[model samples]
Target: MTTHLTGSRDEWLAARIELLKAEKELTRLNDDLARRRRQLPWVRIDKEFRFETDEGSASLADLFRGRSQLLVYHFMFGPDYKAGCPSCSAIADGFNGIAVHLANHDVSLTAVSRAPLAKLQAYRQRMGWTFPWASSSDSSFSFDFNVSFTEQQQREGSIEYNFAREPAFEWRSGKEGDGASARASFAAMTGTDMQTYTRDRPGMSAFAIEDGVVYHTYSTYSRGVDGIWSMYPWLDRAPKGRNEPSGPWWRRHDEYGRG
Candidate 1:
């Protein structure tokens, strides 16, 4: 009854061996890329960046929690949004499990957002996550990292993210199921209009502290973050291989059966 390719066990093994060769090459290339990422020069961070955390107001250094390295996931929960981006939420679902291991390896991984600490805490509790989440609401930390943008920047097309300039968000009254409509639906899920919802973007940043000085080491955005998306690797191996014919057909984990 199946329309997929049917083959003898030996035939399948031969094809799988070919795929394994390519997979090995890719793994080696990724190792080389990681070495280059480490070789990238670190920029000293001199400005005072503060954050509100469960412990209280803390400096950027405080985020390291005695570790020499810090990894910040720029979560897209702007001050106006009633909820975090569903995409970011999906990515964050894996955080709690990894935090302890990363900490043991001399790295502190935290999620930073522009939402108020209280709001973030409420959302975190709702999601049953215990990983450290901090608020950059009263600081320029998110803006400095290029994850948060202003209304003026959005209007002027001056938003530079993922290491390139983005054109201003053009408003389109798209028909249902169009790109614009899909974006609008995501915005509504966050309880904001399209423009306001989009001002905050998602990315990750890395930092290092050496002898009392903090330095910005690396950052990545957009598809560059696919490596850290927990579900992607499994999906890549699935028979259907992500199976997203329409694009981004995922919801927050808990919302799967409600609709």
Candidate 2:
């Protein structure tokens, strides 16, 4: 008979102390990262942009909609694109649930896209989304925010890429075998999928509204998705992962089944 001796009190205490130390380190790192984020330099946006809302056409100021802050998710539905980006769609789905909480925080969140009002509305309906989405079809808003490209610029092939809105990722791989000892690896991909569109920029623009005027506060993209749905670990598994089907509650858009 073999009797394995359990760890003594001192060893258990030492292990717990180590865990506490690791936790403290994690907390410090998080605080430092947040402080660095706050220290990011700000750029002044002195231009006026336009958008079309359900009420009517309005300037960037109008997006505030009587709120103190405006957070706009630069959705990846270009004016000429047939559909919205799948990743952007995923983000929108999550936004539908948090719009109310944002309102409580005095921050108005909206999704903005380069598509025309009618087209955007159609897609929004297909997705069953109720969150506010506006159209920047007629304005240089998208181009200014590095989310759009002009036809002439595309033709010239000298268009400046919007690094601010591009997605980035890291990939790794390994081989596996008994005799060969295969290695395995993983990759982390970020940013929006802008390949379908002629232009490849997608980002979020945040504005602060004061006294009936809107001021561009901050804008971010690529890893910005990390702040939204990606923050929820379980969300990564929806649709194909662990999410259960809605049965009859789900309906396919008429347009989707045609093809």
Candidate 3:
């Protein structure tokens, strides 16, 4: 039998009512944060970047697809990897459905990666996703955005990710320590080595166009992008509330054994 606490309906309702007050306060605070996010100053983008899309080739501005706003998911798929990151794949699974709704609302959502177009296409096909994905293989867009780092950056130990320069890790080809082992597991899942896996990091960026000028509005990396994950909000209300003591327990939808 389960050992979870049980209570009378009246007791449960009283506790729930108190929890509701906290939830409401969080909702209000979130609304204020969203307002502040929109009010943040945008940086003007002047670089002439190109990408390979299913539609052949396109410019960064073209990604807006005539919409005034663009949101790019910096998916962690490098040129050296045979597949997309498992974590990113799980996040992208929800995009196909939301992309349509966002497009109708004047925002275009696309995923940008450092992988070649052919590899991205194959992976997208395998995952059955229709969201627009563009390749920055020949462009400096990924580096400029700090989502893709170089070997030199790793050696210097001063790479900016998630907005701040992070300390260097003692990265090895196939290192076997706490962090290294976890990196190795993810790398193997994507059919790449640990070195290749660390080359690309996950992030999301927002852009806006005004008077034909493209401006970067905001970018978030690491756990900051968790709000975009469709599953988490639902799980937050569950009794166990993520219950992820063993780290990430999800895989690409197709990778799961359940039918």
Candidate 4:
């Protein structure tokens, strides 16, 4: 095994210089990534979708709420699901603060979910969030944007692709005692509409700012929820047992539960 030695002053200085070089390389890599992210093509969305807000029905254009631009977050809160996803809940928690700042910049942010207006409002109240959230109970918007699933697909235990061209699922199970099996039986309901057949493709929203609007800006599912938490100093804590995780404020936020 090759062990690193730190004995003389020259050796320590060399190690520090190497660390600074690594940091500079990291900075250069991050700049390259940002440029690549900005190079993604933008898609124009002209189709209008409807949603239910606190002020009643509103069109997708109306979601801009008379502002020049709008940013919609496709929050994961399907109708049949018992509660909003924990990971999504964490993001929504961040949105409360972000909404205020975005508005100050003349940008409006709204969260869209498949849950009914009443249900969403109740949960928002429970979470004590002030961000504007709307319900897409009547629109095929989620499916059109690929964020929800259909009833027939749920019943068939698979997803029909390309206008009934192909069917896909995780696994198939045999019927009781008959030994007859389906190819994909592990499918679950996407909790979307039945009539229009909306597919469940989570994270299908857009980000709009000055100059132009960007569709499907960025999306995430799980544990990476910690990605944005570093922005808040109060929430900035290292992982357990990594270096220092037993600071005074580490456990102080437990009273807030999952928030």
Per model, how many backbone clashes are there? Answer: 0, 5, 0, 5
Instruction: Give one digit per residue, the lDDT tens place, for model 2 in 1-259.
Output: 5464458899989987998998899889989976875566555556877789988888777776677888889887876666676556666777877889998889888988988899889888888999889998888888777667665655555454434222221111111111111111000011223222536344787777655655675666555555675434565545345342322111123323543
Q: In candidate 2, which residue pairs get closer than 3 Å at backbone N, Cα or C atoms, i.e. clash?
A: 167-191, 174-183, 175-182, 175-183, 176-182
**Pairs that clash in candidate 4:** 148-199, 148-200, 171-184, 171-185, 172-185
Deviation (Å) of 107 in candidate 2? 0.3
Q: What is the lDDT of candidate 3?
A: 0.88
On the 0 to 100 scale, the lDDT of residue 133 in model 3 is: 98
What is the C-alpha local distance difference test score of each model? 0.90, 0.64, 0.88, 0.58
For model 1, state the Cα shift of residue 201 in Å.
0.5
Model 1 over residues 161-247: C-alpha lDDT tens digits? 878787787422122233776778788889999999888888999999999999999999876677889999999999989876444
Show model 2 residue runs off by greater than 4 Å: 1-27, 39-44, 151-200, 235-259
Model 4 misplaced regions, further than 4 Å: 1-24, 151-204, 209-259
Task: Look at candidate 4 and tell me the lDDT of residue 76.
Answer: 64
Of the candidates shown, which would achieve the greatest lDDT relative to the real structure?
1
- Between candidates 1 and 3, the one scoring higher on lDDT is 1
lDDT of 4 by residue, 1-259 (tens): 5464537898889887988998799889979976875676656666667899999999876687667667666776777654554435655777888788888877788989988999899878877888999999888876665456676665565553322322433211121121212111111122332222223323424445344443444443222233444334343433322233222122212234744
